[model samples]
Target: MTRAKIAKTLLTLPLLSAQLLACQPADGQNPAQPGQPGSLKTLSAPSAAELQSLRSSELPEANTRFALAFFGDLLNETPRENVFISPLSLSIALSMLYQGASGETRQEIADALRYSGLSEAEINAGNLTLRKRLQNSGKGVTVQIANALWGKAGLSFNAGFLSRNQAFYDARLEALDFGSATAVARINQWASDNTNGLIPKVIEEIDPMTILILMNAIYFKGDWSEPFEASQTQERSFYKADGTTLEHPMMQRYDKFRYTNNTDAGFEAVSLPYGEAEETEMILLLPHAGKDLASLRDQLTPENWQSWLSSLRSRDGSVTLPKFKLKTERQLNDTLRRLGMVKAFSEAEAEFDSLLDNSPLKAYVSEVKQDAFIDVNEKGTEAAAVTTITVGATSIQLPQEPFEMVLDRPFLYAIYDRATESLLFMGALNSPEL
Candidate 1:
């Protein structure tokens, strides 16, 4: 997963009734009604000590389970494409939404996210810790995470919902007229800016009935700690999943990388570190010849993933990896529905009472979209991803024995944070287009 760029779009429609909720008079007599315009209060930013404490906490096992499960589902659904996704981005956005969910809606999301046993405070704290850690700079590496919320003007939302998201996710909130083109442009501009223009647009058009949009953007750029010389990059035959071979520019480097050969798991893996922090590394998993990528992916359970990580060992190795770039757009609505989140998409049964002041308003998720891009070459790797969960939203490791790891065939790769064990970006390179 070298030199990659990614983006995503999500749209949620909360259908509101024409009747407005009754509220106390505008006079300064009683507290303002929840969701009323100007009634919401912004929560103050967390103190330095609080943020430090959060940073010290590790992501819960439940969060890891949800991430691995979602990755498995995405791989199963898109069996052929060059797939790449940011589980952290999706989780952060969903975690924000979870704060506003109640009853069955909360339970369904909790179940789907594997947050069943964790408290909302714990979930939010974990997300904050990872988000802040990923963005901190070390040597030549740069990882950035951004979040935002856009709401339809005049819509009354629960003040607590707004406050919680702001407090935890550091989301910037804006009120917009959904019918206006300017509003759409502004939102897209934010996406572009956050992703360093790798993703110029995440929203094509805003549905009239749509009342809110939640978004997350992630950007990563890093130079290899021991970069390959450009002169060593040579054209070589690269095998494709479809039994075809094409000439691709292959980068060759002889370096000491954490490597492993897992006979039980059926793949050879190598870890390529970036920058001085060595906190993030790209783990490449090349399945043994005769073993299909699909079958190997099927065995990628949480337990297996952990076992593979634990089995990785340090070894000096010769590496040959192709220079490749991929850009993809995927709709995750169907995949999410298959993952036991059936009620949220239903206009009839979806529950979002915590998000709005009016209990009678019925709303559901209409779409979940993502766009991503990546480019891996001799200098290093660059990747970007944007995830937009529109109410309707939806959204690892290693091996070694490899004294020599040549990724000339189809293989899987993951850009992971060593500190948090977070899979920032992942994909399978079936063919080398560049």
Candidate 2:
């Protein structure tokens, strides 16, 4: 069987935001002309000491709460098809944009993102720590994160907004002629390169009135600490949700793993470590026979997630899992709106005055796009995801006593960073090939 290779990318642009307010151009100032190239300015880099200090700072519980809640909402929205998302990528993009938000706009984003208790500064600092922690690697495992901001060249953006993202998120800054065909090519090329080509194109085209785009890309590759022997793979029957059965290449292994059987939760779980350091793991959760995956998901609150992790125990067991791969793309506009971020998409109410010197040129989020890919096989697991937040006008696992767990049906899974207890990637495997 071929080794797994995964990658993902995302792109976003404002759809519509606050009502346009007429204001006279400043003396000697002119409107941005279409196809005109703009200037590029890089923000001052943070010092080693500064980065270290931020790293030592603790992430607030609000961030964790927001992530779990957001996942629940997304699951509710997309009940079918394989769903895979990188909460870290999405949060980082929104946190960067949060630097420029104010008033009700800021409140809407804060409530939707579960930033209730943390100040803007605290959130930014926490993200710096989160990003660095995720990128830290041990032998045989690679985790990378990249952030960028592309804006119309002639437009004047707030200095603080640019500097804050650069210092905290390490976001790259670029000025592009959005009206130029080459602009889209350049942005998509960046996405492709960052995701190792798993997602070659993130955007079909840039909207004419678009002023800026914020993006985050995360890529992860890891070899299981105990790689499953490929020669042992055999064609086995895998039952689908529809009651049909298909022959799948099932990989098997007998080893000691952190596992749990939650009778109350109605599922079993197992955690498989990656790399020699074992700083990362893939957790698989299989529902009991006759139980629905949705029922288990509904119980996945932050409190329950923590309880499950804490409850996991070491057990010698045998595991049989199908080799699978998945690629998914999602539009999150309605989802975010439904999550209490309505004003941010309203042209009349959105507030982003901090992003531009032209007060009347308020910006609002328009679209949010994400593309993800993942592959799992005998050697290991590799996954990537990209998230883009556009603005134009306003807007697993288990274990048991020498127990045998054969995954012959749909299951839920997660890629987690052990060092920080971060959920890097999550999905439901409804089919082996999707």
Candidate 3:
């Protein structure tokens, strides 16, 4: 028999726009003409002292808060669909872009990312600490991060702006000939290598208006610390969002786990660990039959999430997770606007002066796109996420008392790093692969 693969996830930032995509929902997605190009210069890194000072729990919580906000809006738009996102990766990528934004544009992006109460230094430092803490998390687990900047050959960029991202985010800055096919292949190659080949390509063709491409790819692999018995896996009833039932392979496990039951919120959650140290876990929240994901979306706030997590106590429990695999591609222009990041996408008001040196270059986030993949079974979980920022672009649980939590219907899940309280990946699953 072949050995089972571990869980993996990739977070990518790919920014590109045909014509700046529409910022308004009613207007729909309309591409904008490509803007100017840019090349990087260097400055000093974000303060190391800043990173040291924020070795606290607050930063990870903020990153998670932002992810939940994004999830809520996604649920609002497609209440019955499946969704999985990596907050840590996107936060790092956007925080890099934040260095180049100014005025209302900067503030709007911050608000949309839930970056309030955080100074720019704190944001950069916090992200830097997170990357360090999570990369070498636990034995038997692998978490990889890769960052790169692709710009038009002749474009100009601020020295300090490039330096901060390169230092804090570990991004490789390069001025590529966007007009050449080789540039596309190299960028895609970087994505593929970083994600372990999960996502081979990000952009099919570079839009001429595409001024810059910023990429951040995160790949994570983890095996279940307590592996489920493959023999226990069998076809079981999985309730679908469209009022149908699927006979999917449901892997069953009965053991002691950190669990909590939120009676008031009408949901139960359990944390399944990976690797020997159990530093990373998959926190699964199964909503009550009547409540569904919609109920959880409205209830998911930073305060509430922390409360749910705190409430978890170890106890005997049984979890039945569907063995499934899925891939999703999304253009995030409008959703971002709705989240208070409007000015960055506006052609008239957008401000990215920090990204320019002496050239007559002005750029706005054209489009932000993400492609994600996940697989789960008896062995463990494997997943990858890529959030390409085309400068274009640019949950908890509970349960105990011998709980019986089965993800037979819509539920929420997040791959969390306990060492840093960082959420590498999270999602609402309404449908699973049969």
lDDT of 1 by residue, 229-327 (tens): 999999877777777777878889887787777888778777889999888888788887766578667887778877787777777678888888777
Give the alpha carbon lDDT tens digit for every residue of 1-434 in model 3.
11111111122222221122211111211211233222122223334564456656366667777877877787788777777677666776677778888999999878888888888887877777666666666676777776666666555556787678677777645666677899788777777777788778888878776666777777777899999999999887787767778777888899998887788898888899999999898888877766667777788898898888888788887888887787778877788888888988777788876775654445777778887777777778777767777654224335425767777887788888776667788777776773
Which residue runs does candidate 1 get wrong by more than 4 Å? 1-58, 392-402
Alpha carbon lDDT at 78, candidate 2: 54
How should the candidates be ordered by lDDT, best one leading? 3, 2, 1
Better of 1 and 3 by lDDT: 3
**264-284 per-residue lDDT for model 2 (tens digits):** 998888888999988788888
The alpha-carbon RMSD values of the candidates against the true structure, listed in the order shown, are 7.0, 6.5, 7.6
TM-score of each: 0.85, 0.86, 0.86
Cα TM-score of candidate 1? 0.85
User: For each candidate, what is the lDDT?
Assistant: 0.68, 0.69, 0.70
